[model samples]
Target chain A: MDGIIEKAISLRFEIAAVILFGIGFINLLLQSNLIKKIVAFNVMDSSVFLFLASQGYIEGRMAPIVTNGVTDAANYVNPIPAGLVLTGIVVSVSVSAFFLALVQRLYKHYHTVDFDEIMMLAKERVE
Target chain B: MKKDMWKRFSAWVNGTSEERGPLELPDTAVHHEKKKLFELSDEQKIRLFKAGYLAVAAVVCLAVVSVLLYTVFQLPLFGDPNNPAVNDVVERYVEKGLEETGAVNMVAGMIIDYRSFDNFVESSVLFLAVTSVMMLLLRDKNNISREEDIQEEHERIIEKEASDLILQKVVSMVLPCIMLFGVYVVLNGHISPGGGFSGGAVMGAGLILYASAFGTDKVRELFNMKTFKTVTSTALLCYAASKAYSFYTGANGLHTGIPLGTPGAIFSSGLILVLDICVGMVVACTMYGFYVLFARGEI
Candidate 1:
């Protein structure tokens, strides 16, 4: 437990990210509002990005941008994580847009954005 | 007497007669009995299930978070250079990226040059999302109801008549600066931290501001469905073509004759700059398109 506490102190960013992920997960599970669910999904994505970015950081190193023609590997943090985070961000945005669009359609059809209400209405229609 | 009778007839015709008995509804005792027999228990069951589900979800979420936190403890220390992720691939990209990709922004070089296909696919995903959204939300004769049409028409009139003076004045001054900044970001992406995606987003935001201030009709004059389709498709096609060429040449070990001009220059990085422009265009179009489609269900 002492070692774990020491490590957690060192990896506070990761801990925060994990906590954020949990918050988003719980909200996603509990929230019935479609928009809130999308927001939670984005929160989860942001947490993952935070974790990935933290992993990429190296002490006293600059960003991946080459300055003054310095091409040394030791001078920069990991560029791969930045690139991955960029990809993740774009994908998440796309997913969010698609999800919101679907919700809008649901709102149009059922006149409600409540996930459970929509489900109930859809079932009622089917029956 | 005749006048009174005529007045009573008119009141009856207009549904103003007050003398009426209680509405005769069917026997609801059976329904009440049925509800008592089944619905009450069903409602209780649903409520119980919902509460139980939430409790379980909370427990699961806590468990997951704890497990993840524990896993984090097992991982290497944060900001440690000797971590396993800082491997040969990263080393090569950091050291040789400038010379090979001719991009001062190593992230730009890595994304648009080294892993251009992935970036291309990312752009495609954005394009696909906008397309799907348009398919779902675009107002057409088939999907639009009469009331919705009237409501939209009324909104357009309101937008036209109630154009806020302050917004117009402020946006007019700021819009040009925003457009310039967005263009600057896109143009300087290779030399700086800002690249296609961020720059495109900035430009799209400017377009949105302009639309919101001046109304969609004005924006439509310059950027309509045809313009959106043309710009996005052209950008995507250009990106695919250039990336495909580079991939083919690299595979065949043949010189593609594309000059990797000196790094840190505005017009350098071979195809990275061009690819960045293409991506910026696509992203800008997509952003504005999404706004227009969502707001007016057209565009």
Candidate 2:
């Protein structure tokens, strides 16, 4: 018990990221509005990125740039994670844009963003 | 005989045999009359289900969060230089990134040179996203109605007539600086913290501001659908061809012959600067295209 608390105090960023992911997941599960669902999905993506970025940091290290010709590994935080985070950011933006466009089309067809309402309307249309 | 058997099989599957004749859609009048009887019960059932779902979701979310947090505790301490993540890969990147890629920014060098195809695909994804959005939302005669056309016309007129003077003035003053900064970032991406994606986003935002302030029509003169399609496709093609050549040569141990210019110079980093410009163009076009398509449903 004491060890868990100690680790929690030290790994605060990871804990916060986990909590944020949970919040986003709950919102995604509970929200019926498509737009709100998209926002929640974004929140989840951000949390994952936050976790990745936190894993890359080293205390007292500068960013992974070759300033003043310093080429030592100890002088910079891990660059791989930064590169990975960049990829994640671009993918997330693309996903959100695609989702928003899909939601817009759905709204145009059903005149509502409500998930349940759209389902009902779609059933009616098929019948 | 075979055709007769196939016809009968399909009829049986569809419940359209002689006995049933064909499936019939329920009568709307009867459906509405019956709906009233079940509506009250259905509504209650839905409410109950919603409540139960929320409770289940809450429990599941809590369980997930707790499990993840527990795992976090087992992980190494944050910000420790001795962590497993800071491995030989980091050593190679930081120590040799400049000599190999000639880019002062190690992250930029790693992504653009080492994993060139990944970055290429990222830019392609952005282009694909904007293209998909355009397909889904671009207003056309087939999907648009008469009333919607009139409404759009009215909105366009209002946009042109009452363009906010304050926004116009502010954007005019700031637009040049924003564009210049974006260009600077893209140009100096190899030598600085900023890179293609961020720089392109800045330029895209500037274009969005200009469009919103001055109206889409004014912006269209400079950047219409034709320009957008051309720029994105050209940039993507250039990125793909260059990256493919480098990858091919490197794999075969053939000389690429591309100069890794002096580190920290504007033109350093054999292909990173050129690739950065290509990516920046694609991203900038995609961003502006998204805004224009979403706002005006054209371009």
Candidate 3:
């Protein structure tokens, strides 16, 4: 129980990120507005980034910058997670832009932003 | 007269008029109100169903969060040196990265040299995303002349006094600086914290700001669909070719004997700087292309 408490105290941010992920997931699942769903998706993406980057953190270490003359491993945090998060951020932006474009097209076609209304219209068209 | 100009300038910069109007309800709310006339019972039933669904979703979300929190308790503490994430591989990258890649910025060196293949794929993904967006949105023009006329008229109005004079002036002054800083970030990635992705994003934002301040036609003359396509394709191709060469050389145990110049120098990191420029080009074009396509349905 003490170990669990210590873990909880140390990984508070990660726990918060997990909660954020859950909230985003629930929002994505429950929200019918396409824009809200997109926002929720972004929230989830950011939470995952936070979790990964936090994993790479070491106390008293600077960012992975080779400063002054120091080249020791202990002087710098892990660069891998930061680099991966950078790539993830770019991918998220592109995906969000593409999704928004699709949303725009859907609005043009059905004149609505609600997923339920769009699905209803689609169903009627199919029938 | 100058004060009036300043007032008009501030208003234009703020993108709002002096006359304030009452806030209007959103279209969805208005539509729902209209639908309440005949479908009252159905709306009530739907609301009740939605409430039930929300409660269930909330409970499920709580359960998931609890499970995740429990798992978090099993994971290593934040900033623990003995954590598996701070392993031998990361240690090597942190220690010998400057010597091997000749990049002062270890993160840049690691991404652009040690893990370059991933960066290459990420750049290609940006290019692919823009291509997909273009495929989805680029419409064939049947009434070309009519569309051109409309575009011309729009441009004329935008270029005329209707456009924000102060915005145009400030963007004109700031845009070159933004572009130069972006290039600096891309070129100096080896020695600094910024890299291709960030530099490209800044450049894209500058292009977007220029397009917004001036008319799209003016910005199009500077960077249109052809320019975007050419830049993105060339950059992606170069990145893939360079990474492939490096991979082949490493696999065959052949040292290409490329000079890794002194760290903190601009041209130090053999092909990293060149690849940085390529990635920057792809990212900038993708960003600007996305904006143009989304705004006008065609670029």
Please report the candidate that would top lDDT against the real structure: 1
| Native contact fraction (fnat) of model 2 | 0.96
Docking quality of model 1: it rates as medium
RMSD vs true structure, all candidates = 10.0, 8.4, 15.6
Give the alpha carbon lDDT tens digit for every residue of A31-86 in model 1.
99999999999999999999999999999999989887788999999999999999
Per-residue alpha-carbon lDDT of candidate 3 for residues A1-127, written as tens digits (9 for 90 to 100): 9977777889988987998899799999899999999999999999999998899889988988888979999888888999989989989987998898789778867999999899768977996
What are the per-residue Cα lDDT tens digits for candidate 1 across B1-299? Answer: 34445656887788876563112324585455455757567678889999999999999999999899878988899999999999999999988998898999999999999999999999999999999999989998667888778999999999999999999999999999999999999999989889999999999999999999999999999998999999999999999999999999999999989998888888899999999999999999999988988899999
How far in Å is the alpha carbon of A91 misplaced in model 1? Answer: 0.8
lDDT for each residue of candidate 2 in B140-229, tens digit (9 for 90 to 100): 865677766898899899997888989989999999999999999999999998889999999999999898889899989999989998
Candidate 1: Cα lDDT at B132: 94
Q: lDDT of each model, Cα atoms only?
A: 0.91, 0.90, 0.85
Query: What are the clashing pairs of model 2?
Result: none
Which regions of candidate 2 are displaced past 4 Å? B1-34
Residue ranges of candidate 3 with Cα displaced over 4 Å? A1-6, B1-52, B142-161
**Each model: TM-score of chain B?**
0.89, 0.88, 0.79
- Across all models, the iRMS values in order are 0.8, 0.8, 1.4
lDDT of 3 by residue, B163-215 (tens): 89899999999999999999999999889889899999999999889888887
lDDT, residue A96, model 3: 90
